[model samples]
Target: MSHTQTIPTRSSINPADTWDLTPLYRDLDAFEAEFSDAESQVNDLSSYRGKISLSPETLLSYLKAKDKQFLIIDRLYSYAFQTSDEDTANTQTQAMKNKTLSLYNRFFASIAWESPEILTLTPEILSDWYTKEPELTNYRHYLEDTLRQKAHTLSPREEEILSLSADMSYGPQTVFNMFNNADLRFPSIDDGNGNTVEVTHGRFISLMENPNRQVRKDAFEALYHTYDSYKNTLAAMYSSNVKKELFYTKARSYTSTMEAHLDCSNIPTKVYAQLIDTVHAFLPSMYRYVALRKKLLGVDELHMYDVYTPIIRYDSPYIPFDTAKEMVLEGLAPLGEDYLSLLKEGFDNRWIDIYENKGKRSGAYSTCVYGHHPYVLLNYQGNLDNVFTLAHEMGHSLHSCYTNRHQTYINSNYNIFVAEIASTCNEYILISHLLKKAETREEKAYLLNHLMDQFKGTLFRQTMFAEFEKITHEKEAKGEPLTCDTLCSIYSDLNKTYFGPDMIIDEEISMEWARIPHFYTPFYVYQYATGLSAAIAFGSRILSGEPSALDDYKKFLSGGCSMDCMDLLKSCGVDMTTSGPTSEALKVFDRYLTELESLF
Candidate 1:
């Protein structure tokens, strides 16, 4: 007997496999009604703009009303985006998402006088108001954060002008997005089997992973050379982005772009520097891993294109969705009974949209509304990677679940700096469980390879990108031109440093920086490195049955933005402000590399 599988339409999908969004809204009519009411409430916030500092009661009332309005808006936005993601081709949902976004924009614009007006009053006055109106105590932290920006806060008119420039400031990123996604093109490459395959942004990584060296080389060269053809134009776009960062940095009275970006989350500059220094200390381990790749491939010279190809080949059995769930549950048992119970609840309830369907989004994500259980969207294919992805995204959902249950709406959202920790920590725990259960050498080796790759890609690779950003921005700040040559040279040198002496730094890799979308976002890539490091540190302690490790980690998960991200991490005993967590993470990488080397 033979069977064929097909992607189902949204309406045709099994109800069990789809998320129960009725928890958010029962029908379109209900959503529309709530949305209309929320819009009215949001618009009414403008009346409280200048009256924010009127009196204690008025201030408290405005704050409460604002939070109430936003909570409704959050639910409406969540429902619209989740629905749109279910079937991107559906015009109705798309329109709904756009409408919600417009209202969201208006909501922020309506409250534009919030910070400046709040800053007009001194901290002592607010503290007095807090005592006078006990209810104002609830927003103590929120008010403190606003006051923290008093030094950087401009006059209302100046602030309004800056806000007006928001759309104009996004010009560089918009141009790059259009050019990279729409206009940029690459030539077709011959597949190892004499088939021609077009190199696309989506397909480039898969091509680089092709077992045939010639195919990998072809894809790498084709993609980079096409980028190289427009190197000057790309350089200008990146330079413009850097200039914009500088403009805002100076405008906000921040000493540098990194300072301005990190200030938002109260992160110290030392944390960024510490990550680079710690990663540099462990470059030898990365070189050893690179050497192992070269030995496993039995190639005299390993090129940049060769780095992504798997050193070991194993064809594991197809994983059914049920099996994936079982695997995740078994793998995450180290997190204890309460965690497992919640995981099972999410599974039993329709909290997850579990499979691919026609017109659905291609990747995976976890989103939450304040009062509802978090929802995870997965385009689950029956594979080991998909299983890991399931574990990863559930980590995010459960994190939000814990936070929403514990924190108020105002503090429920965590910063992006610590966002990936839960997800990556879940990944580490799952991989550890799988490693313990593997009965065959090849299986163990394969699992070990996957674990090592996470270290390489997340910790090492992202830190390198972070360092590149640091150097380029510093040069631009010093009035040095970031021409195509200068950018390529800096990138090429960093690649050689990170990949070590075993790997050949191909000329094509020099143009690699032009293709990175993250660089346009300033100093954001460092968090991927720091998040993984913190996750590994926490994972180690929890798995070893360290006392209070599990409880402390749960506290961190429930923290949300209730505290500074660094303080929250520190309370969990993984202080990212120092190099200890990153160093320990590197040590684990070294241990794994040793074990994998011994297996070979």
Candidate 2:
């Protein structure tokens, strides 16, 4: 029998199996009512427009009102987006999602005056206001971070104009999403059993891990060939997106687009450069890992298609979604009882939408609604990898849960800089547990290979992507053209450099940049690399019984945007400013590679 998992339609699935979105709204009627309410609130925000700078009390009032408005808006968005994601082909839901997004953009444009108006206040005046209003202490960090960008902040009218155009700014990504998710179709190939299977974004990863190289290569070629056919359009979309970044940079008085993005989280450009530098310095480790993979696979020359396949295949059991939940609970036991209890509560309360159905969104993510439990969406496939994804996203869900419970709404939403730390920590912790509990050499080797893959994918590959982003941005800044051929050449060269001499850098891999959704969001991919480094270091400390490590980790989760990303990591005992964390993560990868070699 073929090892293919059949995906079902949304209507065919049990109601109990889907996420209970009631926490967000009672129904679409309630959602419509809330939408109207949100619009009214957006109109009301103008009342405080000219009054925010008057006094600390007025500022507090504005902040509180805005927070309330945002909460409703968030809930509305979460409901719409998640509902649409359940089945993208549902026209009604997609329309609702589009309307909600438009409302969100309008709300954002309405409040664009807040930042510029707040920035208008003198430092001493703002400090005096802080002293005058004790309640203002709750938003001190928020205000400070806003003021930190005062140099880039434009006049109130200009800021509002920019804010109103925010929806338009997401054009590139929106186009990519529509094309990749809804329109583009992949050709079917035989799964070695005389049965034809169509390629999908969700199933592509599974197909790559197939033992048959022909299937993997066919899938890779088909996926990229489709992307290549639209290379000119994609190139235009990506270039426009990069130029958009440049426009913001120039509009905000920033030196570069990268500086603009990093400054949002108050991260220095040095940190970004250091991440790339540190990873490049450890290229030999990655090269050795690739060499080992080639040796283990018995391939004379490893190609991009072979990268994801398991060298030492394990005859693992099909872990059902319920069993996966239990496994996550067991893997996370090291985090203490309260954490375990909360995890169980999430599993019990229908916080998750598990399994893939027709037109369902690919991959997993955890999103937040202020007054409710964090919601997670998963395309569970009854595999061990799916179990890890469960743990990873739950880490995000619980982080949101903890943050919302402790912090005010204004301080509740954490920055993306620390977002991946929580998720990847869960992944590493689970991997560590599974490694120790493996009953056979094959299992241990499989787990070890998984670790190596994580390092390669997250650390090395992301850094390479970061480099590509930096280069393309610089080229665009220097008035160089970013055509299809240019992007492919740049990306292809980086592939050769990273994969080393042993691996064949297929031309199809050049178009890989066009396929990545993250490239549209410049400087975002590097966080995964930085995040994994911090997670590995923190996981080591906690598992080794470092004092106050768990407490500090929990505190970091709860801190939300109350502190800068670096400070949050520092509080958790990993300083990202230096190369220490990245170096240590590389060392951990080396250790895993050694173990995998010994086991093999």
Candidate 3:
């Protein structure tokens, strides 16, 4: 039987299990009407085009109008995007999503003149205007941030051309999305019962953890074999993607693509550098973990396919969706009554789409339309990982809730730099609680092993990816063409270095670079490492009874771009500038390793 048989169509799924986009728009007609109105607002922006710097009054008025325009367009896009994700096969919803994006592209082209015009003013003049108009205080950070990029701000015509290119820039991502989700298909494999089962990206994870070594190897080989066939196409697509980054960085006169991407969040390039360095220094722990897995499984050699299967069978209880919610509530109790109450409100109000459905989006995400409560999308499977996913996504939802309540509309959206902290903190706290409540030695070992895996996947693997991106981007920065052979060689070497001598270092692993979507966004994966590190620091503090720790964390959540992301993290007591938090996180990982070894 096909595993997807258990998945339901959008119409067959229960209403309560899906999110209510009604909060965003009452109906499709409402969404259409807003789209029309937002287009009008975009046209209206022309009136303020060259007049943004005429006076403090003009700038403030333009900013307010811009905020209003964004609010409407974003809401329209959010509704359409979620509707399309509800069922990717729905052609009408997909058209709406496409139309919404087109409108955004037009809107972006319209406002492209605003930045360069604003840059026309001197920094001193902008500062003086801020004092002259106290209302600009609401957007002081936004204004100053704009000024900070003055050196990189292009001419008005060049900016307009770049803005127009935005729509086409998504070409590589669009191709990957279509291929990964819609076109790609995997062949069936034997289930050890003489039954053949079709493989899916989602089911591949479970198959890798199957006890039968042949089953795991078959799944791995089948999946990568499919990818290998398309390696040339994928390499070409990714090459174009990297060249686009190079184009933008060189166009804007930045030193490198990594610097350009990090500049958006005002994060120091050194943070990215140090994360890779620190993880490299501590890689022996990763090797040791791999060696232990090899010994426990009694396999002569550990292959890439064998890495995910648990050394100790968890035999964890089958947690239904509702029970998972209750467990999450209990696990997150340390975050205090107000945060808990808000979380409860989200659960009660249908803020989450809680299960997988055929043609629905494959993974999890939390998105907030500024006026409405935050929305979380999940493909809950009732496993331990799903339980933690519930807690993890709720972390994002509550962070949105807190920021929406505290910050202005413009400032309501937090930066990606600090976005992952709350979600990871929730996961850590939930796992910590689970470990404490584990009754048997096997259960405790399972939880500890899960923790170790989390460290491996998030910290070590992501850092390795971060390094790969750094190398590739730096290479391209020096005018090196990222051909298939070059990309594969660099990726293969890094995989071997990170996984150590124990792993079989399958040659197929080299093609892994063509598969990671985040590579489309250069330098984006390192945040997972930093986010996990910050979570360990923050979660440990609150759990260890550090006074006011929870409050400080809440403060960090409530701060939505009110300050720089790095500074906001510092307020929460984790510094990414140095290797301190990353070191502490690795120590935590080592402690869990020691515990898991002792349990054996």
Evaluated with TM-score, which candidate comes out highest?
Answer: 2
| Whole-structure CA lDDT of model 3 | 0.86
Residue-level lDDT of model 2, residues 14-123, one tens digit each, is: 88888999978999999999898787777788999789999899999989888888888888988999999998878899889888998889988998888988887877
Q: Where does model 1 exceed 4 Å of error? A: 1-42, 79-99, 174-207, 218-237, 348-363, 378-382, 479-485
Deviation (Å) of 202 in candidate 2: 1.0
**Off by more than 4 A, model 3:** 1-6, 193-195
The global C-alpha lDDT for each of the candidates, from Candidate 1 onward, is 0.87, 0.88, 0.86
Cα lDDT of model 1 by residue, 1-600, tens digit: 323334478899899999999999999999999998887776687777788888989888898998888888888989998998787767798689878877776677667778899998888999899889998887888888999989998887777677657756868976785577546768988878766767765456667767799999999999999999999999999999999999999888889899899999888899899899999999999999999999999999999999877788776777999999999999999998989998999999988898877667656789988888999998876777678889989999999988988888888898889988999999999999999998999889989988888898899999999999999988988999999999999999999999999999999999999988888899999998999999998999999999999999999999999888988888889888888889989999999999999998
Error of 3 at 444 (Å): 0.6
TM-scores of the candidates are 0.88, 0.97, 0.97
Give me candidate 1's TM-score against the actual structure.
Answer: 0.88
Which is the leading candidate under lDDT? 2
TM-score of 2: 0.97
lDDT of model number 1:
0.87
